[model samples]
Target: MKRATSIVALALAALISVYALFLRPKENSIPSPSPELLAAARPLDTYDFDLVLHPDSNQLGVTMHACFQNRWSETLPDIVLRTWAGAYASPETSPAASDELYNRCYPNGFSEGGFVLHDVTINEQRVTPTFDDAAHTVLRLPVTNFEPGQWCEVSLRMVLTVPDCLHRFGRSQGVWLLGNCLPILSVYEQGAWRTDAYAAIGDPFVSAVANYNLTLSLPERYTPFTSGIFEHANGLYTTTLHAVREAALLVYEQSVTASIQADGTRIVCIGRNKQQAHKPLQIAKEVLKYYNQTYGAYPYPVLMVAAVPFAFAGMEYPGMIWVGENLYGQGLDDALELTVAHEIAHQWFYALVGSDQFRHPWQDEALCEHAMLHYVRARHGAGAYDALARLRIAAPMQENIREGITPGSPIDSFHDLEEYTTVVYGRGAAMLQALDVHTNGRVDDFLKEYVRRHAFALASRQDFEITLADVLKEDMRELLIDYLDTSM
Candidate 1:
């Protein structure tokens, strides 16, 4: 009897060990719901933003609530606001300078990319606003000399114009949506501030306060899609927005498909009125469902995608994707679906959780690329994504390419076609694949945790690495960096 009892005890011990090894969360980890599940719950913070479109003036009245944190460096120059001049010129061929031509579509003396002061309490003597031209940004203003860590409701109103009709300027000239309309604070990471990689401008850092509510009034013929909730609408195209989490508004052509999903998510798109965009529409619905099933439900409960022509090859706007003629021009089969999927991936990587587009491009952008590839793999078969990843690794990096090596090389520097191809886009795609291999399938859970922990906070590269290490194993450090930093 004693021997029999001993045998049963050993069996139970073995089973318990195996279960723990496979199912346990990390050390000191917070007990929380899975991302797939947590997404169904309410978010901790909410923000409200409004964009009053002015097609006649060729500008947008950009207003934002919530708040901001100022951390501009002393050395950078004051950001030049307004329409970008010759922004489409090739980065390699164009002169190394930044200048914007004001279209004067909106009211003047609104403080061109600079700080402005409205009426406050005279006796209150609100904190005086300050701007250092040398830093290229507004430092910090007390506003009301309020207590530290106190939430003060502040609003910034500005006017922005589209530069050109073909690219980014299309948002101004064409009937479409405009993203990143308001200027906030820049991220101060790794000892200095982070700049934007796409525009060669300063980084606007405010990831924590992404929650926002926005309302836009538009033509009856033009339907508007925004980031936050849509409370009610009146004539002339109106929507009341709330929970301003990130800064973005999606504008789409009145045509296309518009409907309320069963999950309470509003899915809209602007594509071929005929059958060309049908598959993309179907694929889009599936992608959204799959995203909720695999990771988490979209907290906003509303996602809008507009198919439109953009300056860049493809641009990811907050609520919609400015699908370019180049994309649909490629035809609406695989290429179009791939492009759409990539943009949808951004809704999570770039939209929900903000990243410093100016610096640390890999942190969120690469992750989005990886996430996109995962979906591509699912739709086309895993082998396809794996093969594409292999092609990326095969393309070697050019150490000689001017200044991809500086401490912040490629971080804040604007990479045009040539530079963007090798580093930001192609290499980033490859690195994600490599990271997948490094995690040994452990990334599934890590990503689930990552978006959960830093969903609405400023996350840095170091923070990502450390979190990854903690979630999996400290030993993964060398493995992850080896694949990400090096050619192999």
Candidate 2:
């Protein structure tokens, strides 16, 4: 009887070991960041950036004094910074390549090259930069001399030669849409630096919320739209922005500004809208009102919408948005209005509640698409929402069904932009819509609580799932597995 009891106990222990080793999810297998690191970097990362734009020479002169606090327990090591401009020079190119129909960025061919860096320094001392092209779009900076919990101040000067193309970091048609032109710190995760490259599809960036103080010098006649508020002084314009991703600057010629007061938030529309200049600002005002009431208040004092012919239909920054000229060229129709709302929705999902856009893009892109649907339902009638659902969600999802793709897959999984749009954006939104139906309108409560829970900080998929389960008072594992294809 004793021997039989001992045999049973050994079998049980062996079974437990097998489950722990092989059956555990990958997310659970990865180690969590140290609590001491989290506590040390308690509040925010900050940057003091100075940039000068010379449109005639197509050059940008930048000097950044970035102070980043180490967010890991392991001390006396190096840090990684991403030079996203190099992705343009790489063979894979930008996200526009995966775009099937629209070829606005490289119309004439891929002739233009990328950016250049010079005068790198660490803590007022010069250091040689090491390139790691294969690992990620990054440059390694040695910080082995510094201790843990220390704020390392690294300064570097760089020059970006803007190509003659309408890209995220190019100038075309007298408009400059400069995105990811700055070398910012890479996100640290799971006791390692996330050094993923800019991919051919999806916005391949993972970042932390940081404050920015910018001083931009530009030509006298050109009006520049920036991610932060500006005040012109002594031949240079200085802007102070807080709690956001990297800064972006868009310069335009023959542009005008219109202002609207929505709940004491100043909304500004910049640049020419050949179709209807006032329409962009009008949509911005209305969308702002609805989102402010539903989700949360637009925390920024000012929001600028610049009507420019950009590579993408619309792009969102912290306090500014870029409205494509393609939508405006055809007039202020449904497409233009919704695109504005979609970008504005990013303010809540992306700018406010940050996520790993590279690894878990569905966190923001998918959520923004669904949030746009909510806006359509609130502003327009049910009919308008149905139409949008058919055009944006239903149609795109049909293609994914034919392609055998799932919505919750990571951004790196998709090869084409259409598939990304169909699966990640469209199907993900559909999943949310279905969840709202399944939960009987309780999804709104979950989202409102989500915003309140993760405002001004980064939240992972697990964080979101835990919050949902807490709200529902039940296990949401089956629902997430079925919809998001998640194992966590």
Candidate 3:
């Protein structure tokens, strides 16, 4: 009897070990946020998505559930969403169709891709949504009475075809880039929804702060780099993002990754190999540390920098940034470091303090460019900062002023990417530099105060001017007019 009992106990122990080895779920690699952070996020809108990837068909099946509250004073007539992926459905309307971006975006030539809405539901009842524009980027859902302070739930079933291109929202070199692919709630201001067109010139996305819960399933070999803290269980990956403007994910077969801690925030870098990953990881760590000390503490818990097949130097989302794969190659060390610093600055300028990128593209872009100067000054020296300022900002602005392009002009006012970058990024930074001189180099203090005031809210051009004036305790109208409004 004793022998038999021991045998049964040993068998049970073996079964438990097997379960631990194969059946038990993997723990979260990232640490949980503080309770205060979690509590602060509870009041924002919530988005939940269940996504499945089909590599064979180059498709993704998505089911989205979102809850939004009417925080506005007046009642709303309908809900508007920006279906940005729909812009890829036709070459005629696609942003990649431009002569400058065509070859670089579609390396193997363009293949058809876009969102196909299967069904939609509002308040648990089936509803029809209207495509309000030619590109089908703006979707409107009618409601009888969306009263103020009322909450609404929206559900959508859709499929996305991954385009065979090297762009941010396409597939390249067996990797899938999912930047701004989700249909998100449109920003409503002044008694109307912002239904901006998907322009090719600059980053045209503008959104409010929200929380996201994403559940993703992919093929056995593929892994996803997401813009949130995530864990894996039962063949599914779940992510949680708090108070972010948008979420981005990059899917690939494999990657070399490294992580470092910066003021309690986990900074992860992903690349095709160790050589590609290590340098960027170190650069990100330094940049984040500098920004935290200079401006304020980073709000999010995790920040990821992933190398992707993209034409641009880098693209910024809420918690994740995509660094162009080419920038990781040999002899581009300065470019890689500068790009990393620029994108990391966006975490404060764009992610933490929201802005209308479509209308005032300079707000975030120019701030980020100037932040790069600060980082250079702190890390290298004042001489390095001045050289970068002269080469990147002063020279470019002089040439752009020749064309009479105002740095604060609307995105549509620029005809192409060159003009857009020259004015918005170059001259815009020049404007801030001028302000720095006028205020006796108090721009850093002003930025710190600005972030404190508009941490998770959208700030318009007027808000920016007001904040600067308040910080300096002086009138800035003439200075702003000379730099931003009047060209040269």
Candidate 4:
């Protein structure tokens, strides 16, 4: 009788264990958290861009209405538009026309690309728009008697001649990389318009956050990767985005793999084939998750990654990033990973916490590179990160330091691409790392608090210093004078 009772107990235990191992339902590894809700900052500028792409002619017929409200105490009398494409007028006129970066857009030459402003209207009245040919990038319109707290609408009809290459704003290999193709309103900074010329060096763009409602009409065969909520219907695609410095679109004929992040963000990866898209899709997902966890939750609903055949490794827009197809093939896994991670970091640094790229590119570039280092360490382990730092950051920075170059120089202060890349990205990251050491690993906390405080706001060097000081409970400006030059 005792043996039978023991046998019955053992049988029951075995059945329960078997059910737990094989038959019971499994729970999700990473449970979805409640969505983080935050209000968007009120946009001071809004743009309504209607563009039609003529792929065969490599041209865009555009009608843009830009509305501006006075963010200042004083009334605004005039507005300036940056016709960036005009910089590609001709090699003889534009110094950067035949440069490598410019040629990336105009592979053949500048003859294929330029901007032509046809008409301008202010408050439903016809007006003349001044196009500066020598500068090749300014369009000024007078807004007389425009009062404070009043909205002024400036309408422009223009033709954008897309070049036959790939850089920022051109066509490359049957795909159109439409970045900075539209007439961007110059940011009013330090009580004046920021009309920086299109330099051959760094990204010569400076703009304030603006709301965009862009409608694109193109062929059905193309899938457009845009920097906003892309809605396609009736052979037209429209996108609406808020608090973005610039809007971008990449129209391509490729396959896209879509996935949903744990935070309910839509991620689309476009590439020539499924295999090409799969790896990047996976990388982007991991990076996205890590960033959302580290910084604030990404505000936008969709994030698009398009692999375009371009020269540059990657370019970050507001909600979309163009990953160069060159990073797809062999012997470039590290480059691919670092590039994707860096661009994703820009979602937080450049997109959410806006910085003056023209004046202090280091604020974003260095910080993004540092964040990428953290991602590499988290994903691949410490040894991999150490190797990456040594290869990408340490060596170049060592060379730059030996050359007596300051890490916090302006965009145009550097002589060439190599110096700029080394000083800004490498040494700038090194400075951040030094700060981490000085703060006893409080850099993570400091950065998170910084993002929370300055989300969707333009952050200057002073703002960064003040935020850091607040975090440390002491002034950090003098301590980090070597890193952030206030003189600039």
TM-score leader: 3
Clashing pairs in model 2, backbone N/Cα/C closer than 3 A: none
Candidate 2, superposed: residue stretches over 4 Å from native: 1-42, 90-102, 134-136, 273-276, 400-404, 486-488
Q: TM-score of model 2 relative to the true fold?
A: 0.86
Task: Report the C-alpha lDDT of model 1 over 445-480, residue by residue, as the tens digit.
Answer: 677677777665566676677778878776466655
Order of the predicted models by lDDT, top scorer first: 3, 4, 2, 1
Question: Model 2, residue 139: what's the lDDT?
Answer: 88
Instruction: Give the lowest summed-lDDT range of ten residues in model 4.
Output: 25-34
lDDT of 4 by residue, 1-488 (tens): 99999999999999999988875323212222123321463545789999998887878899999888867767777788888877666665443453545555456655557877787998888887776557568788888887768888889898888766566767766778788778888888667778777776677777777778889998878777676556777888886776777888888765555544546676777777776667787788889998888887887767778788786789898878888888988998878888999998998998888888877888889889999999998999999988988977779755724344566677767777777888789878887887887889787678888899988778988888888889978777775686655221
> Against the true structure, what is each candidate's TM-score?
0.69, 0.86, 0.93, 0.88
- For every model shown, the clashing-pair count is 35, 0, 0, 0
lDDT (Cα atoms) of all candidates against the true structure: 0.50, 0.76, 0.88, 0.77
Give the candidate order by descending TM-score. 3, 4, 2, 1
State the weakest 10-residue window (summed lDDT) of model 1: 105-114
User: Residue 386 deviation, candidate 2, in Å?
Assistant: 2.0
In model 3, residue pairs whose N, Cα or C atoms come closer than 3 Å (at least 3 residues apart or on different chains), thus clashing, are none
What lDDT score is found at residue 134 in candidate 3? 87
